[model samples]
Target: SIASPWPLLGPGQSTQLIFGPSMDAAKLEEARMLLNGMDYSSQDEDGDTILHIYTAKGLRECAFAAAEKLRDLGRLDAKEHKGKTALLVAVTANQPEIVQDLLSLGADINACDVKGQTALHLAAHYGFPGVLQAILSGRPNVNLEARNFEGMTPLHCAAISHSVTTKALSATGLTDVHLQAKANEKLSCVQMLLNAGASLLSQEIKSNKTLLHLAVKEGNIDLVRYLLRIPLPNVKDFVNMKAHGHTALHMAAGLHGNPYQEEILQLLLSRGADPSIRNLENDQPAHLLQSGHQGEQVRLAARCTPPRGLSCVGKTQCIIYPATRIPAK
Candidate 1:
């Protein structure tokens, strides 16, 4: 019959049914029933039970049914080939209901996959604030500082995610702290991790870049501002820290045409960033400005405020120049 894909299967052997999302409710039931009638512990090569596949595919009904069967069978924590649990799959699939169900069934909330990423990392990276909150509320001991293979905590992932929402910013009463954060900004994940005790001092295992460096490189102006405002232990190290022989200001200076780059440069400067700092190429932040198209803007900004006394002479008068248009490229 179609159900018997594995002939000559031993009693200890595991197998799986290949089902599709297009399968109707009736066909799905039939597939589940057929599998239930056979080995109760059947799994695919990746060690995924039918439950893992259903959760991964966002098949809530199928996943629920499989979870019900597996929970009673004491297989709720079964690991796939990569050590991923059904709970992890549900988080990755954005299936919040399934995630809650698995958690209610006593699934290990802090379970790490092969890459050492927990559900928190996935939720943060995907910007699922609700799911992240659910996980945190359910498991208070869940390590907020768990580093994935890339040496990134949930905080790092939140910084890198473009979809991250700032619901936590309001919930944690941090709205007033991040004044520079735009209205309805998608940086609440950073606030969430910080409130949950994620470390700001943590660096990527490979790049040695701090959260500030990543934020600047990604052009996340709000995040850069938020990090700059953090008190205690001094964020000055992050502002001036060198990565690959370049400071965060050095990276910001090169992003000339970015509309926010000017504001970011100003923020960095106001936070005590030294423009004189040079990179490996012996390039100062001002020297890294792009030429041709952005040269005029950079030059004007560089000239706007001269050294405290260089151009003032004995007079306190500051010269104001008329705005001139730079010829288009």
Candidate 2:
């Protein structure tokens, strides 16, 4: 028989067990034995159960084992003080393997926290592609469009998220590698959500901004380029989508000092964004261009004449023009 690492306690003597970073296989086995002897449904001061504590500590083996027992008891979806289940904790912690394990064990994929954020929302908002993928794969009836307290969907959260890598590097300073990786991860999250039938056109209730509006406003040039390239039936309509009467072009043009402002303005024009469309302030994109040489360049790009067979219809409407077709001086 395997010797127990724990000492024999007297009839009424109880001792606390301390798990440390150096815990080994024997310690884990002893811990498992200890856990098996206790009530799995127990809750702590914050209402965190054994599963929540193990999951938060990143104890995958112990957490999943507890999850299995909790599932058997029909308490897997149990919430703690903040109404977060073990599954939600896994995603928030970016533990993809644990997330997959919980999902396989029948955790609630759609359970929301007190803030109304589901696993999908947390994964997307934090740029955890692995966690997002795990949730997508395991979800039976996942709500892709579920809105959070901010009235933003998972896609909305993804659109505005700076990548985890970028955030980490901000304090140590940034590198091209960091920026490119951030762009790729952000784009990957957006693409996955879109492929799973998440709507590109769903606007957040607060500002009525679509994913396109959010991407451009974030000055994410790569994301903006990728978004515009998607083959929607009415690409022009999508390009000119309004948020509070301001089209994406209006937002880009109004980015007075953003480094990517000129490039984004040019890209929008190349993609048939209607610069003539006015915002609630009745300002066309060109009217919002900053003052100076670079702004003049952006203004020139927007003011390029319509192609041979198309014409500006009115002060508020115009035929689309690709920037490549601008007439030579």
Best by TM-score: 2
Provide the clash count, candidate 2.
0
**Candidate closest to the true structure, highest lDDT:** 2
lDDT of 1 by residue, 94-170 (tens): 77667876787788888989989999898888766556655765356788888898888887887877323333443
Clash pairs detected, candidate 2: none
Q: Which stretches of candidate 1 lie over 4 Å from their true place?
A: 1-39, 57-74, 163-186, 229-233, 302-329
TM-score of 1: 0.67
Error of 2 at 214 (Å): 0.5
Off by over 4 Å in 2: 1-33, 163-183, 301-329
lDDT of 2 by residue, 1-329 (tens): 11112222234432222112232567557667767888988888898999998898888778867887899899999999998999999999888777877888888899999999999999888777777877876355999999999999999988778534334445456566756565466567777888778998999999999998987886766677778778889888888889999999888977787767767777776677876677888777767767777665655554444346544322222223332233443
lDDT of 1: 0.68
